[model samples]
Target: MLQQKSKLAHFFKSASVIKILPIALLIIAIFNSYFIVNEGHVGVVKRFGEAKDQQNPGLHFKIPFIETVEMIEVRTRKNAEKMASSTKEQMPVTVEVSVNWTVNKEAALDLFKRYGGLTQFEQRILDPRFRSATKDTIPQFEAEQLIQDRASAIQGIEHRLAEEMEGFPVIVDNIQIENIILPQKYINSIEIKQTEKNLAAAEEHKLERQRLEALRAVNTADARAKGILKVAEAEAQSILLKGKAEAQAIEAKAKALKNNPLIVKLTEAQAWDGRLPMTMMGESVMPIMDIRNANESN
Candidate 1:
């Protein structure tokens, strides 16, 4: 009877250990299943295949069997791609490009949860959209335009990408066409054409500047001539006024002389003031009488 009791106690202890062993292991696993979310990463939690709101970058507790977590990098990342283009004159060229991009962290969890997942969205949608946008936009521009208007082209591509990536948690930092390889046959021709255009534009600008300068000089000379002519005309008017004043004075003097009938007599009295002792006539001195008085007496 004691042997039977001892065997039953041993069985019960062994079964209890067996039952408690799984619970202890489960508790350890639940405690150890946590993951860290870094500064530039967002965490997505799935509870029984259903997605939850984004988990922050701190400690999080999860049910081991029912929950899964995904971490998505949200920092700016680069993708280098190669493309081809043609010039306006139909010269073929190859261009290599680098695109710096990032996923928007605030919308990361929702994006991953709603639109398949990060990998699916990036592989199926983002990659194709980027390539398509680049191909479409690059082919529209000439080879040299890639070099000359690279900034504008980059901005256009970024804007197009933003529109295409609507509702997706993505941002394009920049798109740079790093290297452009042109066919050797077209290189010289393209350079010559560009040089000619630049020279022609410079010559036109110089000619325009010269024309404006000539016009300014002509206007200045004309103004100076007009100023000198005005001065001469003013001087002439002054001289004429002075001459007229002098002429008036002379006429007034002549009128005064005419009004004084004794002017001749005064001249004769002035002439007689000097004593005259000799006559230079060949004949003897004779007395002279006034004709008007003699006629009146007769």
Candidate 2:
């Protein structure tokens, strides 16, 4: 133990240890003095609990342990608040309001100076203003109108909130009503009406389909009747043409017989069977003779 103590004394007695002790402390101090602001944040440097200046993103330096940096986000942020209010018709509605906001880098120090921090600023001033804006705007819209035209309701709220947030260190990028709770009775009635409307539409469509089918049937009947008439007319025309053809042939035959009466005698001689008929129709029939040869020979 005495040897270890002597070695420690000898180590502390060295000149290098004396030199490095101050350097090590200086290095630690320097490392702690510089602060890094992230890519999307701005640093609020405070000197003795008072706002001094704002620093943009990147490496920055400050007196060690004297100046402290608070990173205030300059990027856009979103938050929602649900509140109850009455409509223009005195109907109560619950609305969930959302606000998108960003800190102005230039006024971050001023914001820190005024509200001490961003959280305090939002909780104390912004929240009240938001509630006021909602109260003022919700009265302008009836409960039914709010349900039917939510865009208009949101616009009214945004406009009023924008006016309220004027001159603040933050810019109100946008405001939205995330959800609106309508009265249950109204919703039920709307659902019933929608159901009736759907049923009526279905009935109308069915009637339209049936009307089309009836028209189609009528057209089919008409087409079929026209087709039958056409076939009948074609048949009648064929019969008439056949009758005319037969009459022409008969006329030719009659003209030939008139020009040559011996053709009739030749026809009768050719038709004779060489057997006498047992009976006659109205009078006695004569036996047919070959007159052509007889006439020619004479």
Candidate 3:
């Protein structure tokens, strides 16, 4: 009975030892099999170095030691780069560009299988293609047009870049032209040209003002001369009218004398004073002597 009890105890100890390792290992494996995928990220599951599936954000399960989970950020990504290129006029220009992009969520697995992650994809494909597209599109417009018409140039570049990166597993949200820089010499020359043009316009305006003033002066002088001529013509007409009136009066008087001779004798008798005339030369007789002879005869 004692030996049987001892053998029972030994068997129980061995069984406990055998049970501990597996439970510990199983706990470890269970911990390692699941991972938490944070929000704004997608998990790519790789089986034996080959992508098999993609998992959205949340808790995800995988075969321990057989499958690996790589969490790729599927959110929008932004990158800014400065590139130097020439315009259609061959003028050197520097452009600072910003690109907003993201991995196509539905094609995340394919993207991971094709190009591992964002870093590799950007370096290998996105950056070079962006640079190439910018170079290709910039030369189609002049420097002045690029500055003056920035919207069209940006649209062109975005379209061309999208076409260039068409087959890739990434989606381009937008391309922004942050800023454009021109050579200092060109900028200075442009400013100088603008200044000269402004000066020329100012001079032309001054000349136009002077011409208008001169024309106004000539108009005023002409108006004054016309007024003076009108006054002179009115005075001449007045003098002519007065002369015609005097001539008509004189002719009427002459016709009255010819028509009636008694009018001349009546005018002479009205002109005589009480005193006798100074001279009566032919057959003159005294009026006082006739009165005396008439009184004596009576």
User: Which structure is stronger by TM-score: 1 or 3?
Assistant: 1
Q: Flag the better candidate by TM-score, 2 or 3.
A: 2
Q: Predictions ranked by lDDT, top down? A: 3, 2, 1
Q: Tell me the tens digit of each residue's lDDT in model 3 across 8-122.
A: 9999999999999899989988988998889988899888988888999999888888898888888999988899999998998999998999988888888888888889889
Question: Considering every candidate listed, which one attains the maximal TM-score?
Answer: 1
Candidate 3 clash pair list: none
- Higher-ranked by lDDT: 1 or 3: 3
- Please give the CA lDDT of all the candidate structures: 0.79, 0.88, 0.88
- TM-score for candidate 3, residues paired by index: 0.59
lDDT agreement of model 1 with the native: 0.79
lDDT, candidate 1, 1-298, per-residue tens? 9999999999999999999999999887877578677787888888888888677787777777778888878888888778776655576778777778787888888778667666787778777788777766766677678767887667767777777878667777677878778887667887899999999999999999999999999999999999999999999999999999999998997897789969867867878958754434445576444466568899
Relative to the true structure, candidate 2 reaches a TM of: 0.60
Across residues 148-171, which tens digit of lDDT does each residue of candidate 2 receive? 788898888788888888988899
